[model samples]
Target: MNKLTKSVLALAATTLSFGVFADVEREFSETYNFSSNGTVRVENINGNIKLEGWDRDQIQLEYTASADDKDDLERIEVEIDASSSHFSVDVEFKKKSSWFGGWNGSSGEVEFRLKVPHEVVLKMIDSVNGNVAISDVYGDIKAETVNGKVKIENAGSDVSVDTVNGDVKIVMQQFKGDQRIKSESVNGDIEVYLPENEGFRLDAETLNGDLSNDFGIEVEEGKYVGADMEGRYKSGNARLLFDTVNGDIEVRKD
Candidate 1:
C-alpha cells in the first residue's frame, strides 16, 4: 500500500479510538481557608450543584465532569476568584453563557459538591440544566436554575430562590428579624416549611395548581385568576412570598 493509503488507515483508527472512549470522566477536589460572612458563588452551565454548610473554617469543593466527547471534559475551566472573606467560582465552556440550560443530551455535564462554613453567606448560584441543593446553612442564600430542582433545607436565615420547570423547597429553622424570603418558579411547586411560633406574612400564588396551608391559615381563591393566599401566621414579623405557574404551593410548620 502507498504512504497516502497507510495514513488514511491510521486516521480511521484514531477516530475509532476516540469514539470508543467518548464517555470520559474527570474529578477535581480542593480546599480553601474561609471564615464567617464569607461567600461562595458558582456560575455553572451544566449538571447539578450541591452545597452544605459545616462548622469548619475552610471550604471544600469537589466537581466531576462527564461527557461523550473526551475534549468536552478537558475543555471545562474551573476558575476561582478568592478574597479575604469571599470566593467566586466560574465554570466556562465554548458555548454561549445562556447555553447553561439549552444544551442537548450530547453535551458534556458537570456536578459540584461544596462544603462551606455554617455561618458563611451564599450568593446567587446560577445554573441552567441541573438541580441546586443546600442544607444546614445559616446565612443569606440566592439560587436560580432552569429545568432543575431547587432545595434549601434547614436554613438559618433568609433565602430567595427562582427556577423554571422545576420545584422549590425550603425549610427554615428560625427567623432573623424580619428577614424576607421569596421563591418563584414557572413550571414547578414551591414548598416552604417554617417554625411553629414564628410570625410570617405569607403571600403565595399558583396559576395551574392549589395552595395548601397546613399552618391553620386560610387561602382565598379567585384572587388573580388562580390560587392565591395572603395572611399573617402568628405575631412575628418575617415575610415570605412565593409563586408558581404550573405547580402547587404549600406552607407548613416544622
Candidate 2:
C-alpha cells in the first residue's frame, strides 16, 4: 500500500476508537392539548427535570435519554399519559442481570424539559437522582428529590419542596391568597425569596447550620449546634415553613 493509504487507515482507526466511547442517546418530543387549570406530574430517575410555564393552552415535552451502552439506552423508557385536563410522564428502567448474575445498576439518564400552561398545577415532580427546576409558573407546585437540587422562580402560588442531599431555592413573584409554602432538606441549604412587603408567618429551623434572613426575623441560636427563627410579617395570613438538618436557611426579600 502507498503512504497515503496507510495514513487514511490510521485516521479511520482513530475515529473508530473515539466512537467506541461515545454515549448513545435518544430524543423525544411530544405535544398535548391541555387546560390552564390542569394538573401535571413527572417521575424521573438519574437525570434533570426542567419545566417552564407559558401562556399557550398546551403541554410540550422534550426529553433525551443517554447511556454509555446501547443496550442500556434501550432499557430506558418514557411512559407518558396525557389528556385535556391531566398529564403524566414517568421514566421507567428495565432491569437486567450482569455477567456475575447480580442486577445491573441504573439503565441511563433521562433529561426532561417541559412547557405547560401558566396556570396548571404541578401536582408532583419527583426524582431519585436528578435536579428539579421550575420557572414562570403560577399554580401550586410540589417537588421532591433524593440526591439533587430543587429550584423555583417566579412562583405565584403555594409551593412544597424537599431534597435529601441537595439545596433548595424558591423565588416568589407574587403570593396568591393564603397559600402555604414549605421546604425541607436533609443535607443542603434552603433559601426563599419573597416580596419585600409580603405578609406571612415564618417558621424556619436548621440543625448543625446557621440561619439568616432578610425579613428582620430574629434568628435564635439553638441550645447546642443550630439556629431557628419564627415570626410574622404584616398580615401574617400566609404560612411558610423551612427546615434543614445539615445546612443553612435564608429568607430573602425580592
Candidate 3:
C-alpha cells in the first residue's frame, strides 16, 4: 500500500482502539475502619443510593461521579471520619472560591452504593429528588427524604422513615428492641404489615380517608373518617405509630 493509504488505515485502527478502551465515566471506591457502635451516614442530592448490610466490620463505599465536563465532578467528594464512638460518611461539595468558580453551569449526577457492617447505625438524608433503599441491616435506621421514596426490607432493628411527598414501605420480622414507625405524607398513603402477634402503643389516624385493620383490636365508636382504636396485642413489643394526612391507613397482620 502507498504511504497515504497506510496512514489512513493506521488512523482508523487507532480510532477503533480508542473507542474500545476509553471510558466515558469513572468509579471511585474507598474503605474505612469501623466499630460496632459506629454510624454510617450517606447524603446525596439527585441520585439513587443503595446500602446493603454485610457480615463484616468495615465500611465499603462505591460511587460514580460523572458529568458532561469532568471538572464539575471535581467538587464532589466523600468524607469518612470517626466521630466520637461512631463513623460518619458525608458527601461534601467543594464551595466556589470566587464569583465565577465551581461548575456554575454544569449538569451531572452520581450514584452511590455501599455495604457497611450490619451492626452500624445508618443515617440517610436526601435533600431533593433522590431515592434510597436499604436491606439486611441489624442496626437502628433513621431516613428522611424531601421529594423521594424510602424503602427498607429485612431490617433487624428499629427504623424511622419520613418523607414529605413519597410513599414509605417497611417489611421486617421483628424489633427485638423497642421500635417506632412514623410515616407522614400530605399526598401519599401509609401501609404497615406486621406479624400476627406484633404489638405496640397503637395510634393511627387519617384526615381525608378511611382506616381498616385486621389485628382484632377494639376501636371506639366515634364520628370520624378513620377508626380510633387503642389496645395492645398479645405479643406487642414495638411502639407502632402510623399516620397519613390525605390518604388511607391500613394495618394488615400476617
User: lDDT tens digits, residues 111-148, model 3?
Assistant: 77888788778865453567778888887888877777
Please provide, for model 1 over 1-254, each residue's C-alpha lDDT reduced to its tens digit, 9 standing for 90 to 100.
Answer: 11111111112222212335557666667677777778778878888999999889888877776666665555555676765577777777654234667654335777889999998888877788899999988888999999899999887778899999899988888888888899999999988888887788888988888999877767778845687788887788788999888899988887
Clashes of each: 1, 0, 1
Q: Pick the candidate with the highest lDDT.
A: 2
lDDT, candidate 1, at 107 = 58
Candidate number that wins on lDDT, 2 or 3: 2
TM-score of 2: 0.89
Tell me which residue pairs clash in candidate 2.
none
Better of 1 and 2 by TM-score: 2
lDDT of model number 3: 0.64
Report model 3's TM-score to 2 decimal places: 0.75
CA RMSD of all predictions: 10.1, 10.5, 11.1
lDDT of 2 by residue, 1-254 (tens): 11111111112222211135587677666677788999999999889999999989999988777777677776776777777788888877878888999797655788999999999999999999999999988899999999999999987788899999999999887777788899999999998889987798999998888898887789999787878899998885788999999989988888
Q: Which segments of model 3 are wrong by more than 4 Å?
A: 1-24, 82-85, 92-105, 125-127, 217-230
Model 1 steric clash pairs: 199-236
lDDT of 1 at 164: 90
TM-score of each: 0.84, 0.89, 0.75
lDDT of 2 at 92: 75
Better of 1 and 2 by lDDT: 2
